[model samples]
Target: MTVLLIALGAALGAPLRYLTDRAVQARHGSPFPWGTLTVNVAGSLLLGGLLAAPVDPAVTALVGTGFCGALTTWSTLSYETLRLARTGKRRLAYANAALSVAAGLGAAFLGYALVTALTG
Candidate 1:
């Protein structure tokens, strides 16, 4: 049961992530990989909100473990950063790492706070 729910969530999440990455990359011209950053932060924010809310374990498993896991690609982020450095965009690579960490944290915190306030 749990596995099925998680799988279902991942099925939706993976494609959504791909589409979002495509759209963002197309809009930004693919220099800084705004797509990866956008998805990571968005996934973090969504996970934070879902966790903070009074939801069941199955809900957490499906959305947090599966959806967010599928939606956010740490491997891609690392690879893109490496590619940027290898291609001589070292500054952009560093910036990507820094921004991903900082913005991911900020979005999670903000999401948690917002959900808590709204629920309260």
Candidate 2:
């Protein structure tokens, strides 16, 4: 049941993530990997909210363990940053890395706070 829920969530999350990434990339044009950053930040916030919510275990498994896990792509972010660095865009690469980590964490914290305030 847990595996099934995760699989279902992942099915939805992966395509959503892909579409979002493409849309952002289409608008922004990816010399900077804005898509991955956007998704990661968004996913972090979502996961935080899910965590803070008084949801059932199954829902948590679906959203946090599955959806969010699929929606965010740290590996892709790292690859893009490394690719940027390898291509001599060291400054942009570092900025991307720093901003993604910092802002992702901040967004997660903010989401958690918001959910906590609402629920509490």
On the 0 to 100 scale, the lDDT of residue 113 in model 2 is 97
CA lDDT for candidate 1: 0.93
User: Tens-digit lDDT track for model 2 on 1-120?
Assistant: 999999998998999999999999999755998889999999999998888999999998899988999999989999999999999999999999999999999999999999999999
lDDT of 1 by residue, 1-120 (tens): 999989988998999999999999999865899999999999999987987899999999899988999999999999999999999999999999999999998999988999999998
TM-scores, each model vs. reference: 0.97, 0.97
Q: Runs in model 1 with CA error above 4 Å? A: none
Q: After superposing candidate 2, which stretches have Cα over 4 Å from the reference?
A: none
The alpha-carbon deviation from the true structure for residue 118 of candidate 2, after best TM-score superposition, in angstroms, is 0.9
